[model samples]
Every structure is written in C-alpha cells, then in structure tokens.
Target: MAEETRTASRARAVALIADVVRWAGIIAAVILVIHVILVAGEANPANGIARTIHNLADALSLGFKDLFNKPADDPKLRTLINYGLAALFWLVVSSVAARLIRRLA
Candidate 1:
C-alpha cells in the first residue's frame, strides 16, 4: 500500500539521519581526543600533522572552544577540561538529536 511504502521511506530516512549523526559525533570525539593528546604531549605546532589536528579541532569545537580558559600556570589541566567538555557536548547533542529523530519517525 502507499501508506506502507511511505512509512518505510520515512523509516529509511530516519535511519540515514541517525547514521550521519552517529558518525559526526564519533568524528568530533576523535578530533577532541587528538587535540587533547597533541596538547598534552606538547606537540610542536610547526609540524604539519600537529597543525592540521589543531585546526580541525578548533573548527569542530566552535561554540565550545572558550567555555574554559586555560590557566597559564597549568595548561595541561585546562586542555583536559575544555576538550573533555567539547567531546561531551558533541556526544550529548548527537545522541539527543538521533533519539528525537527516531521518535518522530
């Protein structure tokens, strides 16, 4: 029936959206981890890979970037907190969005 077909299509659409959201969250988390590692290890910014990771992490962090300012005396702790928060933000947002999409679908 047309109704059944429409329902199936909707379900497929929702599944697709959920996959996208999950992948995006995973990517953001990975970036956050890489950024954390680079900072924690005191990676040389002049290096190509380090610079790339830093730039990508900065781009992904967007609104979450300045949530915590790193103290000059204890930069490691600050990096951990700020990047951890950014990763958490992406995880939560992506999860809630996927749940909502599935519910609506």
Candidate 2:
C-alpha cells in the first residue's frame, strides 16, 4: 500500500509538471501573437505596454529575427512570419516535452 501511494503521488507530480509546461507554451504563443497584432496595427511604440510586449516577443523570436529576409518593405509581414513561426515552434516543442515528461511516471 505504501508503494502504491508513492507511485500515485509520483504520477500526480509528473502530471502537474506536464500541465505547467503546456501552459507555458500556450503563454508564449499568445505573447507572440499579440506582438504580431501590435506591430501590424502600428501601435504606439512609446506606450509602456506595447514596448514590453515587443521586447518579450523579440526575445522569444528564437533567432528568427531575419528569417529569409524577404518582404523587406513590409515590416508587418516580416514580423508575422518570423514571430508566428517561433510561436508555433514553442507550442509544438512544449506539447511534446509535456508528453515526454508525463511518461516519466
């Protein structure tokens, strides 16, 4: 019985960790998406909220900054593609990681 209790607790803990990973991925995706919207809409760069989101998105872009360097004339399109791909990457990686983490139980 004691061993069974330990195993159940371990499973629960793993499940919790997996959930955290999944949520984190979802959050990253949301941030990237928001940044894309802000840039495309030409939101005021001076605004504190906009600036913060832009910084976060820049960091999360995962070196996709230039990405192909196409569409140089349209900054909005560039941001949408690069940041959008980064967001999708995080979502996929996090989901796979969560699944692998759950398997540890």
Top candidate, metric TM-score: 2
Worst 10 residues of 1 by lDDT: 63-72
lDDT of 1 by residue, 7-89 (tens): 89989999999889977998998899899999999999899999998898888887777777758578877877888788888
lDDT of 2 by residue, 1-105 (tens): 999999899989999999999999999999999999999999999999999999998888888766857788988998899999999998999999999999865
Model 1 stretches astray by more than 4 angstroms: none
Clashes of 1: 0
C-alpha TM-scores of all predictions: 0.88, 0.95
Score residue 33 of candidate 1 by CA lDDT: 85
Per-residue error (Å), model 1, residue 51:
0.7
